[model samples]
Structure formats: structure tokens, C-alpha cells
Target chain A: MTIPVIAQLDELRSTVAAWRADGQRIALVPTMGALHQGHLDLVRRAGELAERVVVSVFVNPTQFAPTEDFGRYPRDLERDYAALSGTAVSALYAPTAQDMYGPNFSTKISLEGPALGLESITRPHFFAGVALVVTKLFNRCAPDVALFGEKDYQQLKVISRMTKDLDLPVEIIGVPTTREADGLALSSRNVYLSEEERAVAPRLHMALQDLAQVVSRGDPIAAAVAQAREALAAAGFDVDYVEVRDAETLEAVEAHDRPLRVLAAAKLGTTRLIDNIAVPRA
Target chain B: MTIPVIAQLDELRSTVAAWRADGQRIALVPTMGALHQGHLDLVRRAGELAERVVVSVFVNPTQFAPTEDFGRYPRDLERDYAALSGTAVSALYAPTAQDMYGPNFSTKISLEGPALGLESITRPHFFAGVALVVTKLFNRCAPDVALFGEKDYQQLKVISRMTKDLDLPVEIIGVPTTREADGLALSSRNVYLSEEERAVAPRLHMALQDLAQVVSRGDPIAAAVAQAREALAAAGFDVDYVEVRDAETLEAVEAHDRPLRVLAAAKLGTTRLIDNIAVPRA
Candidate 1:
């Protein structure tokens, strides 16, 4: 059965209120439509954690710079609905931009910690937009738990940090990144890749794996990063960054005294791809 | 009986959860704890709106600048407890600074519209600090509705705008400012007034009254504001600002096509006081 799509803010609240009245726990999976296997996996995991699950599909314009793909970001509500039809998802909250942000909307949420570098360096306004919209979703949905895919590792950390810092009473659970058989992480934006670019996309994940392995063996961090960047460049990718950092804080790591993460962001033709892997403690 | 003062985040959440489970609607009255009749009035109004009302007495340091009175801000928990003893207040959420903002608290909420000028022009860090801490309190308390006194008229407008802009679930209700018989707006900072300063303070409110009267009767706004400023200065106060603004947006008004407010801030000796009056339509 297809899940009900609530477009009105009042309707969403009433639906949540009704579910809450019945003592049902709720989980939220926030997305920007154009569903993929990864999003489906989030909905499924949301069901495991909650009796009622709400999936929000809002292509937040603020998260995208004017030069970025705000206009080109694929949005298919019907396809998203079809993707989650068989899942235990309770509702699909798809508020229009006007409903989400009305006239004279002048409030913004900015962060300084985990949202500092990574995607922010390339897309300066990215995390602030993410933080504001995610906060709005958390407030509107009033969920007990919210699921975010680890495919966007930096975003997951930023949201977790914002949730804790703001005292938002919701548990942020990061699901393991879903991947295709070829190992490229499943993403809605993956469709932007041309046929040739799609074939070469798996190399980003491969580079992260290689970087993680070398860092785990106590190899020089700079050398591991250089190798990843070189491999991406050889594969016709324009590398943005490849580095090893403390997993929790996303700060630069030299000794790996704590858990470490190897992250990479690079562009395959016009499509940007990012991937990360945990560096095992030596 | 005195209300329970919850200082821990988890305890506050559990308290809210228990109230929710009991099907109780909650209201919040946030203050800085030198509780006067104005704050008590907010708590009383909060009870009228919801079955349970949580009063948060936090002297939030973030809202004060280094040069401001953060270190000496009035905080009397025992006195505050006594003040709310016979009131309908359910819980007192007085989380410590360390609990409210942890070691790595890096998130901030900033506004552009209502928080642009007036008090913000003088205390640039003030509203941002208030915005962040209030957002945190709203998240932790999860109140169904929150009340703020109009004594801090700009702050009430700012919080109202923020709640709408951010889609925060709580409804913001503005309570009328409570005043002494002599008509000085009740404030925690009023405690800083000396005997001579206290006698002269009522003139600020009188100036706002006079400004509103002239503007309401079709006097030129600039002329009316100048008169109010001169009157404040003549009354031995250092005038900060005296102007008419759109009540809803807090923007300067050329024509009184909408509701208008006349506001003034002046310092008598070391004590800075602010007051506003509504301009009745002609």
C-alpha cells in the first residue's frame, strides 16, 4: 500500500498528533526526493526503530549555492512514493517551499564545529542550509528518532552535533551507507552521472578504502592522501579533498590516537561524488 | 508548594515526557530569575494557556557581551522559588551554564529581520545569544506554547518571528508588560537603579507615551522622535534611541498604514532602561 503524502503543515501535525495519541513512537527520514536504494534503506531502518515513520522530501534551496544544482536537482514525487510503497513508512511529508519557508523568513542556523570544513570548503553555504532545514524538519516532524544515511558522513556528524548542541530531543541514528554491487554509494545524485562517469564512479569508494587501509597500517597520512588524490586524478576525476581526520570531530588527525576517518570528494565530469571509510585503530 | 527545579537535561526531558504521557499541554515562561511581578504574570498567563507550565530561570551568559552585566546579572534561585511558590508553575527548568552549553557547543541561531536594529544596534551580541538559548530551552522543554512579556517588546517580536521562521512547534504568546503604579516597566535589571535614578526612570516610559500620542495624532515622525529624545535628555538621562517603528516588523515607518510602536532606551547613571508604547490609531 502506498503511504499517504501530506503536503500541508497542519495536516502533517495532525497526523503526527493522532499517531502520538495512540502511543506510537515515530522516526523520521529526511530526504530531497529522487529516491534511491539508499533512501529506501533509511525508510526500512526507520520502521525498525519506530512504530510510525515519516519521510520528508524537500529539495531545500538554501543548502545549494546559486552556482550549484538547485534548479537541476531531480525531484520525482511519484517515483519516491513508489519506492517506499512496500515499506513500513507511515507518511511522506512533502511541504512546498512556501509552506516550509513563508514570506519574511529571516532566521538561520550556523554551526562552527563538525560543519567547519569538508563539503563546506567547496560549498560554503552547504551545512548552514542543511542545519536550518534539518532543524525545521525535526521541529515539524516531532519524531522520537531520525535516520540519516552515512553516505553523507559529514552531514550526519553535523546533524548529530546540532541536535545535541541545540538540545533537540531526538535521537539521530546514522545508517551505514548503502552501495551498489560495484561499491559506488547509492545516492539520488548518482543519476546525474553519464554512462562513462557511472562506470568510473566506483573509483571514489575504492580510493577511500585504499586510503583507510594505508592509514590503519600506520602509514604516513600525507602519503596516503596524495595516493588517493593521484588515483582520482588518473581516473579523470577533479579531486576536491582527500584527507584523514578524527572521526568524531572531523579535525585533522596525525597520530590516530582516536578513531579516524578517510574522506574524499571529487567531481566525475559534471557530477560530484563523495565517499568515506573508517580507518581502523592500529 | 514550590515547583521542582530541574537542572539536568535528561531529567527535564523525562519530566516533559511524563507530562506528555499524561496528556497534559505544557507552556513555558523563560526568564533570567530576578523574578518580579512581570515574570510572575507570565507564569500565571502560561498556566491559563496550558495544563502544565514550566518556568525557566536561566541567566544565559551567551546573551551578554563582555562589557555588559552578565557577571552581575541578578540570580536568586531561592527568591525565585519563593516567588513561584503559590503560582501554577509546574516545573522550574534552571539548567546550569555548563549543561545548557557544553564544552564544544558551536551552534548559533541568528536573525536578520526584527533583530536588526534598536537594542541590537547597541548590544550586537544580545539577540543572537537570546535566540540561541531560547531555541535550546524550547527544544528541551518541548512546550506547547511559550509566553514572553511585552516589557521587552523587541525581544517578544524577535522570538515570535523566529518561532514562525524556524517552524518551531511551540506557539509564542506575547503577554502585556506589567508595570509599577508609577509606570516604569518591570525588569530584573531595575534592581540596578539607584534612588535618584529610580525616580527619573519613569520619564523614559513617559517619553514613549508622548511620542506615541503625537505620532498617532498625525505629527511628523521625525519631529516627534526629536522631541522625545530632547525630553529624555532634559530629564537627565542619556538617550540611546527614540523612534516610531512598524509594530510587526520593527522597521521604520513613514506612514502609519499599520500598527506602530514608539520605543526608547536611555541610561540614567549606570542603569540602562528601555520602554515602548503602542500608538493608538487616529
Candidate 2:
């Protein structure tokens, strides 16, 4: 578990190529350097999938809005390096802000799918930033596969599409959400919630669960969405959106042919949390 | 002098890797099919620069507009192979349209450059197509350096900017133009010209030469552009554009701080011709 820290771009390329030459399969775990348990699970899965795992800790500024928490975002690399010391990661590509973005940088990619709608509502240009940085990391790491957690369900779908669309020579292996003993999904933003805010956060999960049950009972797409909206309102959520859309197209479900997501975002006090549950059928 | 023809993308990757394993530096000469003397010059130069040269011939469709001749594009593999029979090109990657654009492929790149204005005037979506296909070829080949010709001046500049901006892991090398006996720039589209059209085509080059002579006298930028336009009109050309602008920024020049281009496009009857010359600062 000797995780080498790489800063320079060319040096990272040669090091990864050396790993490939040794016949060791490589996996990438991309992160924003706020190594909560949710992100740690992805690194663990990367270890399980390949002989060598690379944990990329880049807090991509392009992915955050000007009004967003890009400046105040937490970064404690020494603590993160220690948490992964006993795990499967072989390197930590902890590049600085300048290392990733220089003066000549100007390419901006427009991302599609769930991220577009979600980010558009709260943080404009958020998905473009995510798309640009993720593509950058993909080019940099050249990983055999990349591990992404389902906690960021929309993000996983968007990244999977980006990798496939661009013919990036890496597979995106999605890991399931890591959660507390309570039903709340584990996330770095969870730290910002107050005691009362934290207790009621599970209501998001409960609302999703209620919608999933209604969907299984053969309610139409509109009904399932309606039920979920009511549940969130009853729980005192400042509801952002509750959408029922085709899992594949990320568009409104015209006819219920495939998987659907009952997705929601809400603000409890000052913390904003998002979650989703796949409706197996509707 | 065995010019290896690699069909699959993976085979090209592995073969390049094997050559690198044996300590051979590789240079890539990427081209759209219909190889003329200009493309051959690129291949020859690649052979000179590195121990191994990989020439890729794919008529990338993404860069072609709906009205352009994509399906009807000429491909003379037998002729091309014969032309390079004695050259030291270690391999030739001539993939089918199927291999390059997979069945479900649907990603397109938009290159935001100063030449984007020309795209709207000439062949909207042309630069986007150029950027996407060229970037794809760069990723697939992963060469020590890639070669482009100065004939397509805007394209060379765009790709150079793209490589720098993206931090792509390859060096870009530019080769001077290879001209026909009549001093006409050799292009695949030259075949489309009628005998009379072909006779008048060299006048496009003549007009640029006259403009360069005027610019050499340190005439004001607008005055030199006006002179180029008059020369094109005198040569019986229906001019599309004739302007002098800074090379890198593509902005209209006030003074010569850098290289400037006297660029022109015209239609001699049904056949369109374009040419440019670098203005020598007096």
C-alpha cells in the first residue's frame, strides 16, 4: 500500500505506463479530496478490481459555480493518505490547482444526462466543469477502469456516458452507496447538517422508498412522482425537485419500458442533500 | 521498407508499445485518405524525425458538413501503398469507416477558435469536425510527435492550440507546403476541378504572392488586404474572403508584432480554390 504522490503531468503518465508494462491492471478512484467514507468505499473497490489502484485527489474548480463552495472546500491530504495506507491504492495523483489548470487552458465540455438538469437548477456551469475535469483525469490516468460511487447517482450516469461517448479506454465500474446505520446515504456534505437536520435527512430516503413501493404497485409514471412529492412535503423538506424519468434516456418517461429513478434534492437548514432510488418497474 | 498495414486499433497500440520496448522513437503522420504528394512529404518527414513512422489514413466523416463530399471522397490505397513502398514508414493504419466510427458512436467536438468564423462562412461545423477527428487520431496513435502541413494554416494553428490547452501528451510538428508544378497547392479536391478551372486555380496562388509583396512594403494591414482583394478581382476570381490578420489570434492586425496571413478564397466557375501566404515584415 505504498501510495506515491504525483504532481507533474508527464511524470504521472510515465509512472502509469510503467505500471501497465508490469502486467498489473490499473483502476482509478477520482475524488475532490474530501475523503469521507463514501469516497473511501470507491478506493476500496478500486483495490478489489485491479492489481494497482490510483486515487486522484483533485478538487476541480471548474465543476463548481462561482457562488458554490469551491473556496471553502475541505482538503486534508495527510489524513486522506493515511486512511488509504492499509487499502489497495498504489498512487495518489494529488496535483495542485496550477498543475491541472494553466493559462493556456480553455476547453469547456457540455455534459448531458441527469447532471445537466440538477446542476442547472442550483449551480450553473457545474456539469461543464465536471465534464472537463473528469476528461482531464481520464487522459492523465489512463486507468484500465474507474470506480464511481452510486451516492452521486446522476454523476455516475453522466461520467459513464462521457467515457463511452469519447471512447476513453477505461471502464466505469459503479459502486453502491455507503450509508450510516441509519438509512441516510453517506456524503461529505453530511458534516454540515445540524443534529435536527441530520435526523430528518433520512426522510429523503423514506420518500424515495415510498415512491419505489408505489411504482411497484403498478402506478403510472405521473402517480409515482406525485406520491414522492407529497411524502417529501410532509417531511418538511424545502423540495428542489422530484423527477420520474427514464433511467436510460434521462428524459421524461413517455412509456414505462425500462428502469426509472425517483430522484430528489432538498435543503434542510443550510445543507443541501440529493438522493435517488431506482424504480425497478412502473 | 516493409510498410506494415495495421487494421485494428489495439494492434496499432501493441505494435507501437513493442517498438518502444525495443527503444525506437515513433513519429505519427495522420491523414485523411486520397494521399497526394503533400501527405507523402509528411510521411517522409516523420521517417526522418524518428526511428519508426506510423501513417494513419482515415476519411473522418465528423469533420465533413452534410453538403460536403464525404461518401464520395476518393481513396486510392493501392496508389498510396505504392508511393510509400520505398519509404521507411514502419506501419500504415488505414481503418475502415466502421472501425473509426463505431455503430453506436455519437460524440462530436467543437473547437472554439478564431477560425470558427470561417467555418460559418465556408462549411459550418468544419472546425469542430477537424478538432474531434484529429484529437481522436492523436489519442489512438499516442505518438512521440504528430505532423501537420502549413497548407491548412488555420487547422495547424487550431490543433497546436488544442494540444497546448488540453495538455495532450504529444508534440506537434509542422511541415512546409508541397506544391504542384503549376504552383497550385495540392488538395484532394483538386481532382474535382475542370480543365479550365484547373488552369485558373493557380491565379489564387498568384494573388497571395502579390499581396505578400505589398505587405513586405509595410503597408497598413487594411490597405494590404484591399490590395489582395483587388488582385483576386483582376485575376477574374469571384472572391469569398481576402483579409490580413495576425496569425495566432486571427484578429485583424494594426501592426506586425508577429506573422500575418494574406488569405483568400474564390470560386473559379463551380470549383472553389483557397490559398494564403505569410507576410514578411519589412
Candidate 3:
């Protein structure tokens, strides 16, 4: 049964808390509500893991840069509802921007990291906004386990770091990145790509796949990364960053840490997509 | 028999949780472990509120500024144990800095307010540190209610703000500032003062009390604040700031909107002290 979307804070708590007391274990999938395969994957996983799944579909305005695609970002509820019609998602908390951000809502948690190097440089305050809003969502939803897609690899890593470091009693589970048969990483931003740019976007995945193959073959660190950089350039993609870091810590590989992730972000036309794969253990 | 000083996290949890489960309501009073009468008042208040009380004696290095007296701060376990010996306190946790701050400690929460504006001018990262460490303590202690002293009025307000904003499941009870008979606010820092400085230390309280009196007489806010500043100067105390702010919001008030707090901070030689009063509702 689709519980109606709750917009107000007080109503949301009372409504959810009532459900909680009735022995329903909640699973929350926090998203910005441009529902795609990536979002559905999260919803389906939450459905699998919990008795009642709640998907908070509010597009947090603070997470967007003034110059980023906050206002212009595509949003359609009827279409999204159509997508998750038969899924385990019990309700959608599609609150307005005003309801989520109160007049006195100013304080935010900020995280600095080795994973946040170049990605942070381009989108300063991006992770801070992401961390804070996710934190608020955790407080509101009170889920036992949260499901996230590794497509936004750093974000999943950041959530894990924040959860453990703060001693918040929630388990973070990362599902593999969903991708098109042709290999473009599944993203809500893919809507912005034109036909030609969309055609070339799969080069991102191919480059990352090549890097994973090299690292698996026990190639020297610098050489494997360089080969992937060359492939991205040859594929006509505007590369944002590519780093091979320890999967758990997100710390840059100093002397060949096992279970590394070869991560990449590249722009095709107006859209940016990221992809990552684990470097197999020796 | 006195409760043992628990250093292990797991040991402390079972000891406290068992007491709580037996229908003994629990209260926590967190301290930095020098254990003065001010801290004892908080423990005493906790005892009054609940059947079981836990006193956490962690100096909280995260709350201390890097250049501040984190290393030099007083710590006396033998004396602290002797002090809490005869109290109704059920448990004492004295986790080390390394235990609290493990291998990749990163997440920090910031509390918002003009309450933050109090000491933020001199110590920029102070409230962020305070908010982060207190949140950590709450997670570990998991008390039904926590006791704090309003002597560090801004710190108490910030902790309460974070608790409410985050929907943390703990009641915050602010006890009135405990002071010496001579009116000097009791603090571990009082040990740093020479006898001459200690003699004038009570002037900080006198100045705040004078402002409280002026506001009571219906004087203009600016005039009452100015008179308090003059009082501090006449007592040879180096005045840091004197102002009126909303009792709840901590926002500046030129005119009374709600009950206001007349607050002052000053230095007598090397000792810095702060005091505040809830101005009678106008």
C-alpha cells in the first residue's frame, strides 16, 4: 500500500512513529527524486532488507550549488510513482524545499578527505551539504539499514565513514553500480546528454574497466592509472578525476593496498557521470 | 561499595544498561574529570532526576582548540574517585583520548545560534568542537537525560540545540551555575589564578548581576549594558563583552522580545571568567 507523501515535519514524525510502534522495521532510501534505475535499485534493495521501505524523495536545495542544476533538474512524481508502482516502497516523503529547510537551519557537518581531493575542488561544500542532509534524513527516518548505489562511490564511502565515526547505530550497505548494456553508468544526470554525447559516455565505464583489468594483472600503480587517463581522452570525454584508493578508507594508495577502487568521473556534453570497480586482491 | 572507574567501552555499557533495564531511570553528567564542586552539582542534579547516574570524566580533546590547554588541562583520577566515592552515582567512565578518537576520526557536527556567537569570536572552532564531542558522549552514555551546567551557558545552549535539531533521544536538563559563597563561578581554570586575581574574580559575577539589576529597573538596554561594562572596568576586570540576547534563541536584542540574558566575560590577570543572568521578563 502506498502511504501518502508527508510534507510537514511534525506530521512526518507522528506518521512514521506510529508505523514504527506497530512492529514495522523501516528501511529508508534517501534520494533527490529524479527517479531512475539507480533509485529503483535502492528502493528494491530497501524492500528486500526491511518490512516497510520509505523513500524520501525531496530534492534538497542546499545540496545543489547555485551554479549547479538545482532549479533546472528534472522532477516528475507521477512518472516516478509509475516506476515504483509495484515495488516494496511503502511511501514517498516528497516534502517541499521550505519544509526541509527551516528558517534557523544553518549549521552543517563538514568532512575533509583524501577521497574528496579533485571532486571537492570542483564542487566545494558539495559533500558537506550531502553529509548534513543525509544526517537529517537518518534522524527523520530512523532506518535500521540504509541502501545506497556505488555509482556515487565517494558518497557511499562518505556515509559509511560518517556512520562509524559518529557511532550512529545504522548499517550502510552499498549495492553495485547499475549500468546500461552499452556501459554508460546509470545516472539521473544522463537526461541532459545529447545523442552524440550519450553515445560516447560509455567510454567512462570502458576506461575504468581497463584500469580494473590492469590493476588485477598486478601492473604498477602509476602505469595502470595513466592508461585509463589516456583511454578517457581518446574517447572524447572531459575527465573530472580518476583515482585508485583503498575501498574502505578512501585513502589514496601509498604502497599497494588490497581491495582498491579505480574510480572515474567524466563529462559528456552537459552531464557528468562517475564509475568505479574494485581492484582484486593479490 | 564504590563503583569502579570503568575504562573499557563494553564494560561501561553493560554496567549502565543493566541498571537502566531494572527500571532505574538513568541520567548522565559528562565532565573533563578534574571533578570540582560545579561538576558535583551536575552529578547531584542527575541523582535527583533519576535512580541511576553515570559520570563521564573525559576531557574531550576534540572540544579543545589545538592551541588551547588540552594537554595541560588538569586530570586527577585518584582525587576524582575519592570525590564521587560517597555519591549515589552508579557508574564512572574514564575512557582515554585514543579510545574516544580512534583511527580515522572525521565526522563533526556544528550547532547553530547566537549562542555559538558567545565564545566563537575568540575561539573560532569552539562550538563545532563542543557540538561534536558532546554528541559523541551522548551516543556512548545513552542516558535518558543528561545534565549540564549553565555556567558555560553558551555550551549548554549549544548542546541542547544540537540534541533538539538532531532529534537525539535524550532530555537535556540545564542546572543553574554553581558558585562559591563569594560569588565566583567554580571552574577548573580557577586553579590558574593567583590569589590577587582570585580576589577580583567574583567581579565577573557582580558585573552580570549589576546588568540584571539595571534591566530590572526598566533602563534602556544599551544603557544597562554600558553600566555593566563600567562596573567591570571599575573592578579592574578586563571586560571582553557585555550584551543582551534572547533567552531562548540567543539572538541579539536591543529591545526585549522574550526574557533576555545579560551576559559578560572578563579576565582578571591570567584567569578568564564568564557569567550570565536571566533578566526578569519585561
Candidate 4:
């Protein structure tokens, strides 16, 4: 069955309220509208958790810096709707920029912990934008559960921390990253890559996995990360960051007595790619 | 009837959910638990708006700086409970600091617009702290409406802006400021004033009133505000600030073509007093 599309806030609220009155549990999957297999998987996982599912597709301009890809970011609403036609999504909430952020809008959610380091250094305002959008989504949907892909590992942890700290009633669930056969994590920005850049993108993930293996072998974290950075640079990538940090807190780790994650962000030409792998303690 | 006091989050949720099942709309009145007539007025107004009312008495520590009075803030839950006995309050949610903010708390709500000038200049982190606690309260209570006293005029505007910006489902209502016959705004901190300080506290309100009258007589806003500061200082008050601003946006106002508010903050002995009055357009 085709999913009903809701653009207005009042319409979305009425539909969700009716579903709620019928005693159906609701789940939310927030996206940026250029749906890939990764977002589809999140929708399917949301369906498994709740009787009703909502997929919100807003590009969220606040999350993008002026130098970032806010203007060039992919947007295909018709294509996204077609992709979700066969899915269990009950409604698609695709609010306009004006709808999401009104003229007088002026609130931001600042976060620490998982939001520190890595992406924040280059994109200082990124997580604050993400936090604010996710908060609006939660308040609008009032869902029982929300699903996020672990492809953006830091984002998953940041949202989890926000939901807990704010005592939001919804439960946050992170699904494993969906990857291509070549092992590249699926992202909407993948469309920004040229053919040659796309070929080098998979190496971003490959380098993180190599770093995780090195950490698992009890190599010193700083030395291992430097090695991985050199490897990526040699492979024609402008490495942004490659570090090993605590999996939960995202703080830099000295020794792997606790759970650790090897995360990396690199640019192949103009398109940036990020990926992470879990490093089991030795 | 005596109000049932609930401190645990789980108990409060279950009670509110039961009320929801019975089709009762809920209202929340958040306070610091000193239980003055001002807070009681909010509870009474909440009772008029919804079928059930909850007063959350948490002295949010984040709102206070190290130099401020978080440690010496009054704490008399027993007295607070006694005060609400005959009111329309259905439940008192008096959670401890640990209950309201866990160890992993890392989220903060930063606002612009209404949170820009006035109180923010002196108390830089004040509105962020207020936004965070109010967000937690809204999530925890899930009320249909929330009431706030307008004695903290900037706070009322900030909360209203946050609710609209974040799309929080709760309707934020501003209760009129409850004042003493001598015109001192009722506040939990009012008890900290010495008898001598209390006697001089009424001058803050009187000065703002004088400023408003001058503005009404077509006097330039800057000169009127300057005159009010001199008057407050001459009355033996350590003037912190006396300014005229746009009532809604809290931005500095040069003309009274729009609604203007004359707000003043001054120190009398060891206590600080704040007051404001509307400036009638000439």
C-alpha cells in the first residue's frame, strides 16, 4: 500500500493522534529525503518495533554550514516516495524549510560527550543542528520509538544522550550500518562523489577496519591512528581525522580496557566520507 | 483536598497516564517550591485550564552560577506540601537533583530572540539552564498545558519561544505577576531579603513605573532609562541595569512605536531585586 504523505504539521499531528487513539505504537525514522537502502532498512526496523511508522524527510538547513553542502545536497521527494511505496511506513512527513523553521524560530540544542571531537572540529555547528532537528522530530511525532542508523556513529550516540538527558519518553534504537558489497557505508552525500572519487570512497571504511584490527592487537592508539592516516593519504584521500576513542563517550582512549571504536573521516576530492568499526577489547 | 506528593518519575508517569486514559487534560506548574501566593496563583490558574494539575518543585542547579544562591536556596518540602493542601493541585512532583539530572546529562537548549538581552547580559547561562529544565519538565509531564508566572518576564517570553520553536505539544500560558500590596513582585528569593532590604525593594518597582510614565509623556527612551537608573541609585540601591526594551523580543528600543517594557535589576544589601512595567506608547 502507498504511504500517505503529510507536509503540514497539523495534518501530521491529526494522523498520529488517530493512530495513537487506536492503541497502535508509533515509531519514527528521520531522514533527509534522498533515500538509499540504508534509510529503507531503518524504516523496516521501525516497522518491526511499532505498529505504525513515520518517515520524516527534511534536509534541515541549520545542520549545514555555509561552506558545507547545504545547497548541493541531494533532494528527490518523488523518488523517495516511490522507494517507500512497498514499505510499512504509514505516513511521510516532509516539511518545507519554512515549515520546519519558522520566521521567528531561534532555539538550538547544544551537546557535549559524544558530540565532542571528530566531525565537530571541522563542522563545529553540525551536531547542534542535528540535535535541534531530532528534538523537533521527537516532539512532533511523539513516537514510542525512533530508529537511527549507526553509519553516523557519533550522531547515534549524541541523539541517545540527548533523549536520555532531556527525559524524552521515546526510546532510541540504533541499527547497524548498511553497506554496499564494496563495504562503503550508504549516505545521501555519496551522490556528490565523482566516478573516480566514488571508487576511492570504500577505502575510507577499509582504513577504519584496519585501524580497529591494529587496536585489537594492542598497538598503541596514537601510533596506530597515525599509521592509518598515512595509509589513507597515500591512497589519494585527504584524511580529516582517524582516531580511536571510547565507544560510548567518544572520548580519546589510551588503553583498550573498555569498549573502543575506530572512527575516520576523509575526503576523496570534494565529497567527505565517514565510517567507524567496533574494536573488541583485548 | 490534600495533594498527593510524588517524587519518583515512574510513579508520576503512571498517574499521568491513568489520567490520560480517563480523558483528563493535564496542566503543569513548575516551581522552586517556596510556595508563595505567586506560585499558588499559577496552580489555581492551571486548575482552571485542565482537569489535572501537577506542580513540579525542582530547584534546577544548572540555572544558578557558582556566585549565585544554589547552595543557600530554600528547601522545605514539608512546608511546601502543607501550603498546597487546600489548593487545586492534584500532585506535587518534587524530584531531587539526581532524579532530574543524571550523571550522563550532556544536552542544553540555547535560545536567541527573546533570550538575547536583559537578564542574559548579567546571567549569561541563565536562559540555557531554564530551557533545559523546562524541556525535561515538559517531556516528563506530557501535559496539555504548562503555566509560568510572568514576574520573570524574560523567562515567560523565552519559554513561549522555545515551545513554539521546538514544536512541543504543550500550550505555554503566562500567568499575570502576583505582587504584594506594596508592589514587590513575589519570588522564592524574596525570603532572602532582610527587613531593611525588603523595605527598599519596592523602590525597584516604583522606579520602573516612573520610567514608564516618562516614556508615556513622549520622553526619549534613553534619557528616561538614564533618569530611572539615577533615581534607583539615589534611593540607596546598587543599580545593576535599568533599560528600555521591546517587550516581546527583549531588544533595545529607541521609540515607543512598538510595545516597550522598562525593566530594572538592582542590589539592595545582599539581595537582588528585578521589576518591569509596560511603557504606554505616546
Name the candidate that leads on TM-score.
Answer: 1
List residue ranges in candidate 3 displaced over 4 A: A8-25, B11-25, B47-52, B85-88, B218-223
Error of 4 at B93 (Å): 0.6
Error in Å for residue A33 of model 1 = 0.9
- Where model 2 places Cα greater than 4 Å from the true spot, the runs are A1-3, A111-124, A246-251, A254-256, B1-7, B103-106
Tell me the tens digit of each residue's lDDT in model 3 across B77-181: 888888998787888889988988788777877766754666777777888877777777777777889999988877877887777666667899999988999
Q: Arrange candidates, best DockQ first.
A: 4, 1, 3, 2
Q: Show pairs that collide, candidate 2.
A: none
lDDT, candidate 2, B32-127, per-residue tens: 868888988998899888998988888888788888788788888877788778776788898777777765454455556564554347877777
Expressed as tens digits, the lDDT of each residue in A235-276 for candidate 2 is 778888888766754676646567777678888877788887
List pairs with backbone clashes in candidate 4: none
Give the CA lDDT, 0 to 100, for residue B93 in model 1.
85
> Per-prediction interface RMSD?
0.7, 2.7, 1.8, 0.7
Clashes of each: 0, 0, 0, 0
Write one digit per residue (lDDT tens) for candidate 1, span A42-142.
Answer: 98899999999999999999999999999999988998898888897999999999888888898999999888888999999999999999999998989
Fnat computed for model 1:
0.86
lDDT for B243 in candidate 3 is 78
Give the best candidate by DockQ: 4
Q: Write the per-residue lDDT of candidate 1 for residues B116-211, one digit (tens) a residue.
A: 889998999999999999999998888999999998899999999999988888899989889899999998889899998999889888888888
TM-score of chain A of 2: 0.94
TM-score per prediction, in order, is 0.98, 0.91, 0.91, 0.97
DockQ of each: 0.88, 0.37, 0.54, 0.91
Candidate 1: docking tier: high
